[model samples]
Target: MVKNQPCIEIFEIFTAKRLHWVVKDKGESWTGQYFRDIILTERVFPFLKNEENVIDPDEVIFINDKAPCMRAY
Candidate 1:
């Protein structure tokens, strides 16, 4: 039996016409380049328009491991 645990440590979402999401950890922000090798490269929303407050630390929560990968595909 495998335990169901979230892979994301922290995350945030900026709700607009579309959802812009960001993930951060260890006090370092994750840029697209940071995920260049990951599947997020193709699926991620380029960059926040006007560079608004996208992901709030308060909104951080646990996300299933497969959600991000499936959403990208």
Candidate 2:
């Protein structure tokens, strides 16, 4: 951001049926403990558990994919 405005950062997850979004103030590092403790345990799991989502927690799977540009060349 320029001197007058704030910067924004976001993280997200999705499937054909739904989308989840996380917004954080700029420069917040998503360390492992923070990710496991807050993001998944507090946020995502709850979202998935919501009755409207009709999710079976046992069947959910997560995958992390690097951007093509970040892959070995």
* lDDT, candidate 2, 37-66, per-residue tens: 776677777766654553554456565455
Best by lDDT: 2
- Candidate 1 Cα deviation (angstroms), residue 5: 6.9
Give a tens-digit lDDT track for model 1, residues 15-68.
433455555445444665655443244324333222353344233332334555
When summed lDDT is taken over every stretch of 10 residues in candidate 2, the lowest stretch is 64-73
After TM-score superposition, what is the CA distance of residue 14 in candidate 2 from its true location, in Å?
1.0
lDDT of 1 at 61: 34
TM-score for candidate 2: 0.60
Clash number for candidate 1:
0
C-alpha TM-score for every candidate: 0.23, 0.60
Our model 1 lands, by Cα RMSD against the true structure, at 12.9
